[model samples]
Target: MTGAAIGGGLVVAWWFLPREYPNPLTPARGEHVLGAWLKIAEDGVVSVAVPQLEMGQGITTLIPQIVAEELGADWRQIAVEPAAAAPAYPNTPLAKRWISLWDPATAGLSGGVDDMLAERFATSNAFTATADGTSLAAYEQPAREAAAAARAMLAMEAADRWNASWEECEVYAGLVRLGDRRASFGELAAGAAGQSPPDPPPLRPELADETPQAGSSEADAGPAASFPRIDLPSKVDGSYRFAGDVRLPGMVFAAIRHGPNNGSELTGFNVERAQGIGGIVGAVKTKRWLAVAATTWWSAERALRAMEPQFKTQYPVSSEDIGARLDTLLTAGDSFKTHETGFGEEAMARVDMARRYEVDPFHAAPVETASAAARLSDGRLELWIATQAPEQTRAAAAKAVGLGIEDVALYPMAAGGSFDARLENDHAIEVAHIAKELGRPVHLTWSRREEMIRSRPYAPVYTLVGAQLAGEGEAEGGGAIDALKIRAATPPSTHEFGRRLFGNLTPWAAIRETTGMKDELAMEGMVPPYALPSVTVRHVPVETGYPSGRVRGNAYVAGTFAIESFVDEVAAQSGREPLSYRMSMLGSDVRLAACLQRAASLAEWDGGLDQSGQGLACLRIGDKETGGRIACVATARQGEGGLRVSRLTAAVDIGRIINLDIARQQIEGGLLFGLGIALGSPLAVRGGLPASFEYADLNLPKLGDCPEIVVDFLPRTDGTAAAGFDPGELGVGVVSPAIANALFSATGLRLRRLPLLSGGL
Candidate 1:
């Protein structure tokens, strides 16, 4: 396949197009392969290859829907396939996202720092097709270009046969038509083969330069306002295969017994009598590993439970230990200062109001347990696992078996759910190691308790806010925020993640020093959009033995919670209406102000706290990496159960909406997820291990706990200022603060910590 299509725009596998076919879906004679993303068969059926994982996010459906719309193909005839591992199919959205984290002016430098980071992220093969709300934005440009190229190729083929210029032919509904004479894509498939795909007639603008909401003007697939999803049919018909569905011949079920906490090693075990059970296969034991293989999973479970393996450490440190360390760190001085706008240390001397808030550690608890099935035979290793980072799994698995990545075929399956848990593929590597050592195919699934014990929870965060308000008649009326200083302390999650990304070769500290972003994990999404004369944000890095990783919104959620909550405290202390105080400070940030206004109008804010316990909060968040802007409002009340979110409304602007139905669904999902975290999901630690390992132990919100949520997309009909768009939802970052603000309005007490834990409301 050729690298460049017509007009010099990149098509499929544009970065590193392969000389030979690289995917599993091979085209037959008379069929054409459009680069690496699309293929048209002799029967007019179109296949779209997606590199992202299908974790119930509707990405697989949305991506192909985009292609079908641009290609003029019937949605019914389109099929989606998982793409193979290749350097060409990189996570472009993530690359852009990392670059977005940097603000040239805020970083105290200008030049090409953002460009250098973007280049570094794009070339580095660190991410896989996992669900991170990046799929829609990442694949939008590539999918549109590939489909447009395919359309052009079909038009050219029709023109050649009709003896007319390509301009005279129009492609519609998978048919090339000129006046009344028409040719089906299947009929012109043979002629289109070996010809370079041409770009669409209307040259598309570069994603970076395009105006925001440009997609609102573009036509989507189907005449009906709501587009149908592709996965529902297969899911309803029971044809969709998850990791549990794979039943290979001669495969033995294995159960693992590892340290309860992550990074713990196995010490000893006793399995003599347990292995004698019926349908028992052998046992695989290593210094740091312990597993029992049997004919059935039940048998393996019985053997494992009976064995009762021991680890080097059991509940090494308790919850009190982690809490003490965090409290000490929060009280300590700052180690790294991220951004300083005006007054710096001078603002602290004139502080009019100050508040301290904390977010306790919580879990990104997905329903699915970590699982992997591996077969080692003939010096080749094959793994079928529910992993978000399949490329990382392939590399880690190959290294475990002492084989090259080429020798390992990693098949990423339909995951039940994943926020960031699947990003850590230690289980897949463990399964491969066991399979290789036993010289047999093994299917290892961690029990529910094991998954919880090994879960990488979000680190606890503490923030201290000191602000000086403006006097009456000064700058946009009275009570305007003049200067703000925020100091946040949290265990560094990104540094550890960076270490995993670069391995032992390059230290994470080196990357942090070179980038000058010492603790992005603690400070992102903490910056307020209010027009303040002076703003200083200090990130105090803390060291902890507890395992922490990115979960959904990551630092953004924690940072927003602290920043917004502190703002509410300041407004209350200043005796100004909370909403009005925010609006007064939002000078010229129309998008954010508009969202707050819309939400307030929807909720009918009357400048008084709801006696029935109503709270209102407005937020404006923009992500440069995903190209998204979200303004959300949340209303809460103290119901019979206490702290019930009665309603939530959001005004979203994320470029163009690919599928309105899916977009709304994602927003709703994001709201529920944020609510769960805001309400509670504390993973108590004791003896250096998670004390709460069962689903019942986690105080996750139920359907009854969640109130009605209303979402409205901001109309982008003009398409003037094109900000990049990511299809992911935005409520996670703002929910906690919104809810906390609501609680304060309902009651006189202000909640400084998250999960509202118990009677705090």
Candidate 2:
């Protein structure tokens, strides 16, 4: 059958299959389920089922807060449970967004969250993969409706007892009241479960939101968070469990070593040396990796080191080779136009200014390395792991152990910090194999060296930007850019990642399948947020012989870095101030323009003249209507040790803020992450392996290295903006270019490459 026919057949089959899925959150005795998303207990405690993984993003709290606000439940009584992989909870938004990746041939069959094909596919496959900041967009409305229905049911139950109309009852703070009569949600739980809901759920008119006080001082130190994070208490008390904390009866620890890169195979290992190590249980060897199990992780790691496994690489990757490939592709390779606007490339025959920028592959470098625990018994496989794509992980593990998908059970756990790193499930698959080989429960953890060797980093990019400006005598400096063109040379990173993620192909096979394809997702954000009359973006695919996957900010990081740096250079070439030059082209995007103006005001605008050591940059994440906007001003100077950033001031507009505290925390964290990428996180490939495995060697910013950060959110008027746009990635993309521009302002030299000092003085 053709690809489209197969996809259509699968969707139809899924539709006909039974949709009933047992509730993952089973109610305790005396508790009642009013909706699929939540349950109410006799103690008046509300347990909300969160479908997304909690990777320190405060999602556990955000979702419950929405329920509490709509259901009129007390925040103090709220509890959270991780939802099991089931058909009832499908991330339709994410499914629709990634339709092109998962079902390219039938992509046209899916439109939005309401698309039947996307919904059926997501539901049947239990596709709850969490990436791309789609949690709120995917779950908010359904959660609200569920909560509203539950509230109505509770009121109906209480009203019947009081001989009053349900519509006349008041429900708030976990209580239903009718004049002199009052009853807690716990008192009506059993009765509420049997009560019929209103035909149309009575949703609240307003969404959960918080407003920051005006002025720099007030905004800087906003009111205390109304709803504190739910996970903080357990996390602080060391009671929360991560994948590394999973311990089972007779569970042996396993440490693994994988070949450096794709197209590599394990050749040999010294079994005698490994057996001599104390506490060593046994060793498992595969075609591409070797693992040693022991009583403890340290012992297992030590045994693996003693074994001294060897691997042979057909084509070893090196930084120099990757760079040469990018350079060559950028200069003479055939380019595919990913996006175009206005006159497109026709107006790029002559340009008033041009510049080139380069960015090397950067690792995600999450705090926690890949870890998983697996057990194989009675023709079944059980896995405990923190994965963004739980179903995919389970399927991969089942396939690895030569079992059907129905024979696998996956227990989800919280991740330390993924930044999209947990999307890869190689560790889960390896642990399954190790457990099957040993016939015992095995907890496998990839050593930092193995993670650095096996994990795919973000793609390397080489960009050439050209612009046409008005005549010099027209306005102050050379006036506004009349036309712009950008040509970026990079591997089809997103396509390759999708091949591995959706197709479950090996890294080498993925690369071969998508070597020359144009990846529009990889070229996302290349279209400048500014209002240029004519703009064209071209993607020049380069086969870098190294696998690349999604990092935190994805393409936005590289795109913003190149665009903002080039814009700063253009501002200097013209006599216009950097801030004003950007603001001039932002007439169509008032939200971003407002952010730029506010950020400048907060940072004490200085026009970026006379080596002032202040640089400015702004970006829009989604689009003009519903996207998030951010503007940053970075202050930096050359320090004795190296480059030092003293402070960063940013003004952001993420629409109606859900939790102010979490939003600010996300932006602040994203800024620091971007800073790490700007100054560290360079992957230097040598013989197909990362040159350094230690985190300390990456030169990531320490507590002392972190600059004084000031974040101010643009206050929204009633319904002026869309519901909360994700603030997680907005800060990441803008910080790099802001720091680069600041460095140029500090020194006379413009650094066109990431890791600012990489190009040397």
Candidate 3:
């Protein structure tokens, strides 16, 4: 419960004088947590403050979508606000201990990748670290600990008043009861008002630091009793007073021109010439850029454009050029600690067959996208932006403008879609610095050209697979191909997962590498989907030049493509259908078989998989309930020009479903994101920059692009299902490979490259 609290005080900017209204990304430190406030306002009009901002992923609708299911309030009345970042970090329970782990560096506060590590907090196992305090053991530690603590405090308070042993007390819902006495929490809320919440928190015997003692209270009571669910109506109706919808009296809109490109600094500029322009309030030059302040967005833009900029690009590396450079970085670098599984060297020596595959993912038209809107009130800079990491933006802006952290207010609005791009605060920080310097609210949206020039993209990974088949099989070209090995600059990642939860990467060995099952490098075709008793997989890590951030199922996509393709080959080798081959390795998970059966029925896989060439992919995100998580099957199809996803049929058995609908939406959304990367969104390099400009040119799946999806949830019939992926963790991140493999089955063409826009489908 103890961590470094962001100190000092909030600077209240009073001047509401006309200016561009702020976007929600500019975090406003709220008094209560978003979930807390949303739950408290749950009477009739539940106002849910979403912790995650909505740039376009529809978090505004998504969070409320989940909350409305629980709150049972009218969805029409729901209102949302971007939750403030004052709780130090967003209210993620990924690693409850992430905040409580007591780091000596920041004194129990979170570290740089708090957002990444936070994923683990949602688990349920205890004992904190692995038995030896190394890896995380379980999930929902924060929720679990908080719930247990609240229960303990309630029991203790009841025990003290009833003059009875705390051991005799049991807390249910929001009530404390003993033998013949029962009291609702509302009644005790008043009496317990002044009482201090327990230090180190309360606990239950199960989450206990020590064995339970007779007649005593444990420290980990369930906080589920204290923090209630949010009930805010979603902004589905579009009536919410969003920053874009906010208008104030005498407001003046403005726009600014920073040094060419982003991160370019101004040599210097004269504002006197700008003063001559009509309605020109002022021209401010900050450390890195220049901004034009005027009465209207047009006035500022016109004046700014007219005032020819005099700056030079010091490091003129455009986005397109950066992209090509990324390839050179790959396949040639000292492997930092990416991940390692079994004995890599031993596994490599066993390889007798090898083939190289190049994945030239052209992520076109890179753009430094930002969601920011703000105004200067009195003298303070108040802003809102659509950002993945709010803290990163504030720090950057504050540092740029030389303003005290208190002066820069940020509200993390709903982000559009995070491809690790939103996490870059440079765009927002530059805008804020410009606005503050001009003494005007500046709204800066990147030009299509600029957007493509400044970005980090997924790696253009090149992988080499070496296979050593037990028996000598004639190669398609008359060469013997077996004793396999996979060496690549980029290892297969399950959704660019690098966090402690199911996202992080670990090395895999020959026994673990069934490279063909999903991605030759990632699963090393060693996925349990096959019945291979003896196999080996190895890795050779390389780096990429373009800034690579978390892309949806980053590793899963490439890895699965290689793995499942290999699986198809194995099936072809055995003269068995791919589905039959997959059915063989599924003894470990009969539920997986059930899901496969259902998906097969839905997609009619049993009828004619070979003829129709439908392929499936399933990955396991190991956990406590199901022992291991298996992304049952990501189903896909092939069409004339492009791969038409018939449906990403999924069969998952994650235990709890907080919001049945959102879970489906999240999995579906993630699935589409990965597909978008495959179909038409690979960022490319043209003359040292990304070629695709805006989404218009990028060609992501539109409303029409979405497939006919069938989500299958395996019943915990034996009370043996997982509690994570609530709604369900289908892990559709790597499902594209299955789709690709299926398409290859249908078309007989191997497109290792992404976006079949070249008319190659």
Give each model's whole-structure lDDT. Answer: 0.69, 0.87, 0.47
Ranking by lDDT: 2, 1, 3
Worst 10 residues of 3 by lDDT: 127-136
Kindly list the per-residue Cα lDDT of model 3 for residues 1-761, writing each as its tens digit: 11332333221121212223222233233212222324212122335555554544344554554343333234454556556554422334334333323221332344544543343232211112111111113223433343344445456667779999765777653456898898654345334423444666554433211111222222121222122223223345555433344343444554555443323456655555566678877666665555665676677777767776566544444544543443454445433332334443344446444444455553323233443666667656677776655554665676666767667787655543454456455566667766665555666655454455444354455655555544433233222222334445553332222221221111112112212122222333232333333334444443232333334444445555566556555555545555655666555667566656766665666422544656666665433234323343444555555457766666555444333444455566656666676676455544334555566767877889887766655444453222334321235345656666666666666555544333455
Model 1 / residue 732 / CA error / Å: 1.0
Lowest lDDT block of 10, candidate 2: 216-225
Query: Model 3 clash tally?
Result: 126
Compose the digit string of candidate 2's lDDT tens values, residues 1-761.
Answer: 23344667976664656667766667889889988889999889999989899998999999999999999988999999888787877998788877878877777653543376677888879998889999998888888999999999999999889887899998888899888788998999999999999968998786787756555444532442389999999999999999999999999999988887877999998878766678888889999999989999999998888888999997888999999989998979999999998877788667778899988888888889999999899999999999999999889999999999999999889999999989888898899999999999999988888888878898999999999888685264475788899999999998898888878888999999998998888998798998888999999999988899999988999999999998888888877788878978886788888899999998997998768999998888887788889999999999787789999999998887889889999999999999998988577898888889898978789999999999999876435635689899999989999999998888887888887766666
Task: Supply the TM-score for candidate 1.
Answer: 0.88
For each candidate in turn, the TM-score is: 0.88, 0.96, 0.67
Error of 1 at 497 (Å): 1.6
Which candidate would rank higher by lDDT, 2 or 3? 2
Compared with the true structure, the alpha-carbon lDDT of candidate 1 equals: 0.69
